[model samples]
Target: MVRKLLFVATLSVASGFKVDQAPVKTALLQLRGGADATQIAKYVAYSTSAFMFIPAGRDVFSPGAEIMPDDDKLLGKMFTDKSKEGYMFMWNQWGVNWIMLSIMKILAVSSGSADFLKLGFATDVVTFAMMFKGWIPEFKPFVVMFGLELLALGKLAFA
Candidate 1:
């Protein structure tokens, strides 16, 4: 099962190169109202990760929810519960990371700077390491985030 998952991830990453094609790029650009293809792809990856976690929001927002079972729940509470320090950590610090990365990616592509892309890739690596090193309370979000990150990494690698 793990091998199958790895293979799928590899395939998805490899397929990111397809976005570079003229037809696909044109369609994506039109779909995004003239946004860069690579940027669109990267945002799709981030959006996919966010969407995957949406289902778990119910558990975190439940009226009786208190102690969290794992990092996912804790992370969710960090968003819904403003009284906790984790809320600030999640919104002010952790959540800002993605926005910053997105800006870095845009600058990297726009300036044709390999350095920025390298930095973005490095940040993604560290983020993945931190996420995976922790215990996984749920399988769906983990797998979805991992897969989408792989796709993003693939595009970043080529960009």
Candidate 2:
């Protein structure tokens, strides 16, 4: 019982801090063919911060202790953010950050340092908005299928 509890606790902490696109990590770690260590460290620090804000306040996840009122408010806020007006504003803020990180990831991957996948995660947001505002007229799932961003397992339909 104690071992199982410990495993669960470890998993939670690991999952909480796990950011996507690890290729960025490898590129900066190239000591032999890399630039000054201090410079790389600074860059990494900035990139780490950029990642946190990339998803537009994705760090605003609810804590385990806030299982009641806080969780309810958070659900409500997510709904509000999904609304047409809120979605656009939030997406703009998040989209800018995502584009910056994507550029960095692309540089790192194409330079033979890190071979991480291109993390073009924000294209989905724009795609969703298009579908909602009657831009993409289709009855399918509209999966991007590029960066493992969307997964439509079952059948999808718009009514």
Candidate 3:
């Protein structure tokens, strides 16, 4: 039975129905040894900043206050005012986020490490919290993005 199972496993891997773990483990070991910690730090910073910028842009442009339920309270008005920032602020935030994401991608490619992938997972978690905090039901795009990010994180974390 053991021999039969081994043969099946080998055949499955050879046919690409199963991933061969040896090469992946070897690559991960090499990456752990060779990857620069500073580069990984930079990648994480950029990635996290990029993730934050999306909601920041939305806050400045669309301003969730528009869809917020009507309230005569001063606190509600204050929150609304804070959400509606100037156009320049929103544009600059978006531009900076894009630049950071670009830098992070470059660093990730150069480092050839899985650390960046982990950082991406962290970014998604943080961004998801930010989205949930904002409580904006109108932004369906954010929901879709969160779902996709979670899927990617699961794949990277598990595989």
Candidate number achieving the greatest TM-score relative to the actual structure: 1
* Candidate 3 least-lDDT 10 residues: 66-75
lDDT tens readout by residue for model 3, 104-156: 54454346456875665666677678777866555455566555655554454
Q: Which parts of model 1 are misplaced by more than 4 Å?
A: 1-90
**Global local distance difference test of model 3:** 0.54
- At residue 155, candidate 2 shows an lDDT of 7
- Number of backbone collisions per candidate, in order? 0, 0, 0
Ranking by lDDT: 1, 3, 2
CA-lDDT, candidates in order = 0.57, 0.41, 0.54
Runs of candidate 2 with Cα error greater than 4 angstroms are: 1-89, 115-142, 147-159
Model 1 compared with the native: what TM-score? Answer: 0.43
Candidate 3's displacement at residue 80, Å, is: 9.8
At residue 91, give the lDDT of candidate 2: 48
lDDT of 2 at 8: 100
Candidate 3: RMSD over Cα atoms? Answer: 15.2
Error of 3 at 85 (Å): 9.8
